[model samples]
Target: MKKYIVVALLCLTGLVQAQEALFSGQQVSSPQVNDDKTVTFRLSAPQADTVQVTGDFLPSVKVDTPMGKVDGPGKALLTKNEEGVWSFTTSVLAPELYSYAFIVDGFKTTDPANPFLIRDVASVTNIFIVSGKQADLYRVQDVPHGTVASRWYDAKTLGFDRKISIYTPPGYESSTAEYPVLYLLHGAGGDEEAWLSLGRTAQIMDNLIAQGKAEPMIVVMPNGNVGQDAAPGAGSDGYYTPQFMTPETMNGKYEAQFKDIISFVESNYRIKADKAHRAIAGLSMGGYHSLHISRYYPNTFDYVGLFSAAIMAREDKSGAGVYDNFEETLETQKDNGYQLYWIAIGKTDFLYEANEEYRAMLDKMDMPYEYTESEGGHIWRNWRVYLSEFVPLLFED
Candidate 1:
């Protein structure tokens, strides 16, 4: 017992030292919240060199806008406090989710003392969730809601263990009947976690369900990319294609992950496991997949959604996806069965032209679809809006 006590003391001492290292020379400890909804951060490197903070999540703000401050609503001051220790104070920063690392003398490192963080293995980044006045679509409401299941599944056809995230809607737990499934996909470089973390899809469903705009349904987000599908013709050197993925390759995967996600969601979720109740949707690459998969199977899905969809049909290119003939594929699907083909894209998204062209092609082919052009770019704002409007229209007569 004495030995254990000594060890605990040592750990506590080390923790205190680390904490001191982080909080050193700061004018204010925790950044003060401002009335305008922002927080400021301060950093000082007076004696030695310059100081800057960078993070995986920090997008470039407008000029003159200080760190942690949204639109420069808050202010931070950096000045010399002592011989070497500098004092820095920041203006308020907007809260939602943010990650940052202190760049002392040009060295970037995470604050060791701060506990708030999100992990992706070896690397750790700070995250802050500030309450926003904007309505939250995913917040649990009075209506029954389902939980998100994060798991891995094997893809037999493509040959990979895909990480999958499925959001089962409210009333799923107690309902005697199974719910319909919507296989959702994420964009480039994003895995299954993208939709839940950034998209707030489940919350969007919750708000809509509570308001009676959308029926409760399951949403599955699968990874897209056989191997980082980049600018289509950037050259075969980095091109992620159908043949690129074999049973052995693991580091960069796409097709295999998608196949497994679908199979896993069907088996695991108490879903209406048939073609009539099944749907597919995604943004960017995921949108491309939805177009391909629905067109290929046709009868497998009853509803299809594409947000800022990357549906670039290459006539000469053979192995971008499972579909062989794009025209015949859609024709056969239209013949076999059709569902709600709803596609929404931002006016500024790179895929906007493709979306419009796809719509025109659909019109020529007499393929029924619902197309929406909203005000925004290919970002989360448009995605959220698209989801908010689209969900209520699902599973409807």
Candidate 2:
């Protein structure tokens, strides 16, 4: 018995030593931000023949257009040293949040050294913030932050219980204030968690409200997928299936069911339930939904914003048409005394042409609206900028 115990102890010691040597703290010091504002990335891939870094800092070559460039962070190849560590240094990056991944011989993966990550609908990548001036807006500052709750509510329009993320201002819990509401919707393939995670909605709101740039209001982020009750894996429904990609699920269902979300919010929260205090805005599919919802119920929302919206003027076979009596709808909406009808899109966004067509229609109808164009493509970077700009302009008399 004594001999067997000794042998077992020796084996356990060897295992611990092997793990310590393999994951020594040296390899964990990757993604170090240099004093010059440039960044150095390292990976301890002793056997990897080739490793490359791809991120938003790399410049992207446009594929769809001739003589144009797609917006990207830029890519760089790493150099391996005698110690079997691959390293690469970047030029001074701009002050903002950036996501990146390392490709080892062809297999893409997040940095093991960096645990901070952002998961989108289709992919997951590591994230880092290069902070200084305006980039501070994206960072969590030393301010009284608001509370973000993932609350479940009944969606009678869809006949299932659904979840929505709501952000109440800092004083909401303590103060007896009835605040305005902003129905902030997410894009396709996203859920209630998307805006809070990748979009940094809470950080932006906290910073903006602290700086007095935006009013203290409640922001509701609802799951826009009509076929699914919550984010994939959050409920019994597994990952989103392909059958829900039809036009019926995409166009009409969400708009028809949105009233339930509003009713839930009004009944549960201390919100000023009036058109003048209600706002709706979304990105991509959510933008399309916002457009239709505001149009379908013209008096429901006083502020409407479309961020890189996928607008189609034609009628859908699914009975979710946008342009059926579109001129009359716009005329009636204009007569309803809305506070703001805003549209923002990136210059390199693939949906730029669609937004232009919508703008042209609005111009032809002589409708009053605000248009903003920024630098970048159809990425979260531009959407964040648009939100920052749009929130400040909301609820201001």
Candidate 3:
């Protein structure tokens, strides 16, 4: 027994010693930079076919950071002595956080050097913000600017507690004034925090508002996910419904779950409740929601935005003809006096065809709307570009 105890103790000590840190300290994290606005990143897999570093600062470049441009005795070659280890210095970025990732073959991965990351569903995305972009309204600038708050409440209809977040503009408290409200929604699998963390919304909102690019509207973001991992069919309700089917209906749940959000905001903040001051928008699944809500409850909102929305008619692959029930809803939205119904998505997204098809359908339906498309795939870059383009058009009257 004494001999066995000594062996176990030795084993435990070895195990503890084997634990190596991915990161060093509280400040040492990915998405962050060293004091000199530069960083040396390393990955210990020499056997891997090829490795390339890509990030927010560098879009889709097939090379390591610096690539000998920043500091290399050679041209982008990571020199290793005897032990198989690779090291390279990334480019110098402006003072702020920047997101980056190392790509091995076809797979995208985060940098081992930094700790800050944004989870892209199950996969993680390297994300960081470059501070002081035209004095971003929401970033930490000496004194903390306003923040986005994520809170949960019981949604009786869904029988489950749901969540929502609000982006309070800078000086939201100092001024005693009522503000317009923009209800933002995220795509499926996303939660209320997606907009703040992924979209950098608080900063975008603050910057836009400060720059007079966007009106001073209180932006409200809500989770549009189905309550269950699967909804009714593939979902959890013991019913067999299609994917993206929340009990809230196909994007139709907008009026139901989000109605609570409106009531809460109105009750809590100095906000304008009339149609002229209210707005709603989303991306992908959210875009579909925005479409449904804007069409179904035309009287509630004046500004309607669809970012990479799933707004087109569902294609019946069986060639059974006729997909989605849109006629009545179209008439209803037209009957209501809403002003803008803007639609935008990446040119290369799977939903792109649907958007074009939907636009053709809209032409036949005579449903007036705003539509635009730019370069890029179905990702945050397009969404961010969309926001920069779309927000300026809101509340124009």
C-alpha-based local distance difference test score of model 3: 0.64
What Cα-based lDDT does every candidate model obtain?
Answer: 0.61, 0.85, 0.64
* Model 2 C-alpha lDDT per residue in residues 1-397, reported as the tens digit of each score: 9999999999999999999876764555668888888988999888899999998877764554321344545568999999888999889988888899999999998898888998876678888888887678889999999999999999996788998999999989999989999999988778889899988999999999999999999999998887777887786667654332433545566776778999999999999999999999999888988898898788999999999997864344334454476678778888887999999998888889889998999998888899999888888988988888899988986
Q: Any runs in candidate 1 off by more than 4 Å, and if so which?
A: 1-19, 22-33, 42-135, 138-145, 225-261, 314-321
Best by TM-score: 2
Could you give candidate 1's per-residue lDDT for residues 82-110 as a string of tens digits?
Answer: 65443443334444445555666766655
1 versus 2: better TM-score goes to: 2
Can you tell me which runs of candidate 3 are displaced by over 4 Å?
1-41, 44-84, 88-100, 103-109, 129-144, 228-255, 312-325
Residues 52-171, model 3: lDDT tens digits:
665555433222321111111112333343444555666776544445567666576666655667754444656555444432433544443566776665555556766677887778
Q: On a 0 to 100 scale, what is the lDDT of residue 163 in model 2?
A: 89
Better of 1 and 3 by lDDT: 3
Candidate 2 wrong stretches, greater than 4 Å: 1-6, 62-74, 238-248, 313-323
Error of 3 at 237 (Å): 15
